[model samples]
Target: MNWKGHITLGIIMGLPFISAPEQIFLLVAGALYPDLDHDVKSEIVQRGLYISGGLILVSILAYLFRPEYFNVGFFIAAILSSLIYVIPYYAEHRGITHTFFSLGVMSIILGYLTFKLSIISPIMASLIALIMVTNNNLLGKSIAISVFAWVLYSMISTSFTTFQGLKFYIIPIAIGYLSHIVGDCITPMGCKALYPSNYTFRKKEGFFGVAIWALLVFYVVKLV
Candidate 1:
């Protein structure tokens, strides 16, 4: 599946749990992140690196201004997150990044970064996530713009304290990442989510994909 499908699946899967602006952004980021292993020619890969690079710089600046707040742990976390984006440079397309191992690891890193950043600097985190969502080109722009506008409204009205805990952010990352793997699994090429095992998790696109979407939508409706 393509980025659009991956993001749509992520949103649908996460619909019931989304109660805040950052959750939506996290879901989008998680869905798009697996594609980071794509070639340098892929726009998602380049833009993801750009976002990670910018995040590293932002963390450094924040530390320089207030070591007491940003601290060494925060600085190290930023570097670790930035390194994730760089993995694509040396990784093969649909390689390690598509695996469950990467999914779990990325969820922890990104979840921590977003959680800490939102707690200490909501606006900065919001803006960075906004960029991460909106950089996926035209389709992404439309989805991100609408959701980001909602986030901005929430920020103005509620001071953007909507997300409060680590688990809240991590849930979206895990679900979104899993949804991306599922989406790719339905494609003819299948997915090597197990990795290191040459086994491919393949499925028929039409029936299986529709069933997955239908089940997810039904669950979302049940929540509503």
Candidate 2:
């Protein structure tokens, strides 16, 4: 899915835990995370990577040197800009990277790291990030079922851990990530719904071709 879709999904799904301002940050990061790997041949890849790296660096710097003036708006803009370019360059018409398994793996890894660092509530941030990555090509019912199953398993298995909020985190992350899948469905390069099941969907024309310019405009306006 695109950055707007990512942001919208994050805001919608993250409402349960974080405030509106934080939602914007989480959504933006989610939208840009997939573009960490970029190639020079692809303009989106080059630009997106630049933007994503810049945002991450800026956020880190702000957190370290000027916590009081950390501009969430700037962070959000960087994220949206990066995703706008990256989707077409790297992720569009992709495979598991746009699937539940990929999203789950990313969530687990990031969640663990966040937990270790005690950064921004690991369960909440991880869930938001996972949700942002999830695509919607998989049946909504199937996604829901999967999320529920994971939640149950987490609650049961991690009941004794301090990260007991894993269950609560799973639902939103699943939903948010699934939202990306759903958003991609509207574009030409559809997502692979039954990833491990070998089901694939493709759109003749994806959203990135024309939408990138618009996304840049919107992001600039938002920044202003």
Candidate 3:
């Protein structure tokens, strides 16, 4: 999915579980996660690396100057989370970092980092990672009904009102990200859903493409 779709999906999906502030942070982070591995030519890679590096630097400064800036610590946690998911770039396409396994591993790592930084509870961080990862996988499909179902499932499963509860942020973020992928999947160029699973869906030409584009634009605006 395009950037807009990714962000929208993140926000819509994350809305029920997190405060507006937390949702914004997760949407930005999740939207940027996939591009962390982009090469020099890719805008996502360039922006991600710069943003990650900047966040790390800011975190260090915050830690040194004002320990009360505990929130800045989450930025550091985000950088570390990206690093864990982005390393060994070769494993990216091979589905190592893109699967449920990597999702669990990275969530644990992120949860620990967040706990150490005292930014959020370890459990919250873990749930957030899980939501983001699941959404990422769902976004790669082309079927609208399937995409809607995925979003519905995420909303139903992760919906929560308090942080002390199940923490619905992850599920919404996942649905948002997945919605983007589904949008992309219906494009003429298509998307590889079930990558490594040998399943692919092609887009129908004409109005379907136009409709998808419209929906994409709507979500993008919503997310941004």
What lDDT would each prediction earn against the true structure? Answer: 0.67, 0.46, 0.45
Which portions of model 2 miss their true places by more than 4 Å?
Answer: 16-24, 35-93, 119-164, 167-173, 201-224
User: Candidate 1 residues 43-85, lDDT tens each?
Assistant: 7556667766886787788778966666677568757766666
| Tens digits of per-residue lDDT for model 3, 47-98 | 4346667777777788789878847547756677557545524444323333
Q: What lDDT is reached at residue 100 by model 1?
A: 82
Q: List the residue pairs that clash in candidate 2.
A: 131-176, 131-177, 134-177, 135-181, 136-181, 136-182, 188-203, 190-203
lDDT of 2 at 122: 53
Q: Which ten residues in a row are the worst by lDDT in model 3?
A: 137-146
Per-residue lDDT of 18 in model 2: 29
Task: Give the Cα RMSD of candidate 2.
Answer: 15.4
| Superposition error at 25 for model 2 (Å) | 3.8
